[model samples]
Target: MSSHRPPPVPPRQVFTDPVHFLAFGFGSGLSPKAPGTAGTVAAIPLYLLLSGLPLWGYLLATLVVIVAGIWLCGESSRRLGVHDHPGIVWDEFAGFLVTMIAAPAGWIWVLVGFVLFRIFDVLKPWPIGWVDRRVGGGTGIVVDDLLAGVYALVVLQLLAWWWQVLMATA
Candidate 1:
């Protein structure tokens, strides 16, 4: 057998490695408590940064992240020997992006989207919860959040439309 030894696992840095990077929303997931909340909270600045881009640009970035997130999350989970740990939250970022599509481009809508997305994400209603339970690996990690984003998007759009109708009727 060869004499070479495997490299040592590095000590956890504040914001290095896929697990930490993704778990914290690139650092937001590092909060002492409620990492998911922190991850969602961390998404705001990114949202602000991306939301300013043209819709196409935002859409492209979201797609890239979602694709990359599958690998990152999967690799991290395999290394850690865990499934969908709380800190792996690139999924949340993708979900938030989904929630914003065709959404009102304003802080109010963003806040509403954030809250709604979190609720749907945590509750995992119907198909969202179903996918989370049935799927495995990194694909499972990201799919539930994607569905949550879709749910949030639909609900927010309907609410906006209803508000508009009410305003017109008034």
Candidate 2:
């Protein structure tokens, strides 16, 4: 039998045209290096825009983003024949949303959350790293960032609480 290899797939599109710009996180994934970092950076404006919403509204929106991200990331990966390509970054958007949920409503908190989430995401400590390696497809792409978001949330919450306690005691 003659060896037959599949033709090379084209480079993935960044935004699927203009209509899907927001869905693709504003082409942040197209960054030349550290695309995940770029994706997370792209989320800052969105976080600022949504941070003004009422607490319940913010939480609801975050939930929607997370649920939708799985499908979007998966679909793009399917088209590209790659698993978790850097250019597919709906996960970063969802993770940023999760990080902002219940955070103190201020620029300082926002910056802190952003830094913390990026750190944990890049570091991928413990089960986060494990999940990143073992899981496949869209679920794998998103789950690690989701866990990083959780870690950031927990740490920030504890820090906020401790700050409050310290201030009250002082």
Candidate 3:
């Protein structure tokens, strides 16, 4: 067993490197505890900003982020000497955006999507867990979260639809 652990990463490093800044979710990933959750929290503002665009526009932007996240995450991890380091959270940003895609418009929906995305991300059910374990490089870093987002999106849409039906009946 190698006792040599990687040196502690300086928060300033994220600012110094553009890729690290983004991969760290604009520094939100530097949180001392539960940086993944912090990264997801940082994504909320971005979701609000992008939610106003047309569906296609929103999707296009998300697609761009998702594709770029692979490189951003990979390069940052390589520089940091850690593969998918907890602080490299661009994947969480892309994943949260995926969860909020077409989500019902309201604070409640936002909260629900956030909770659902967090749950799925932390749980890493089935194929998500498989990908997380078997995949490598940036794709490995981002794909698991993407799958989690898809799971959250499905559940969120279902709950929104059911709620609408209930309101109509009421």
lDDT of the candidates, in the order given:
0.80, 0.80, 0.94
Give the per-residue lDDT digits (tens) of candidate 1, residues 1-170.
89553332333753557555664477665555666677777777878888888889989988987898788778766776667766667788888888888788787898899999999999999999889999998899988999999999999999889988999999
Q: What range of 10 consecutive residues in model 3 has the weakest lDDT sum?
A: 2-11
Question: Hey, what RMSD does candidate 2 come out at?
Answer: 5.1
The residue pairs found clashing in candidate 2 are: none
Model 2 TM-score, 2 decimals: 0.85
- lDDT of candidate 2 over 46-144, digit per residue (tens): 888888899999998888888888777877677667677666778999998898788887778888898899999989999999999999877888899
Which candidate number has the best TM-score?
3
Q: Which residue segments of model 1 deviate by more than 4 Å?
A: 1-11
Query: Judged by lDDT relative to the true structure, which candidate is superior, 2 or 3?
Result: 3
User: Which one wins by TM-score: 1 or 3?
Assistant: 3
| Span of ten consecutive residues with least summed lDDT in model 1 | 5-14
Clashes of each: 2, 0, 0
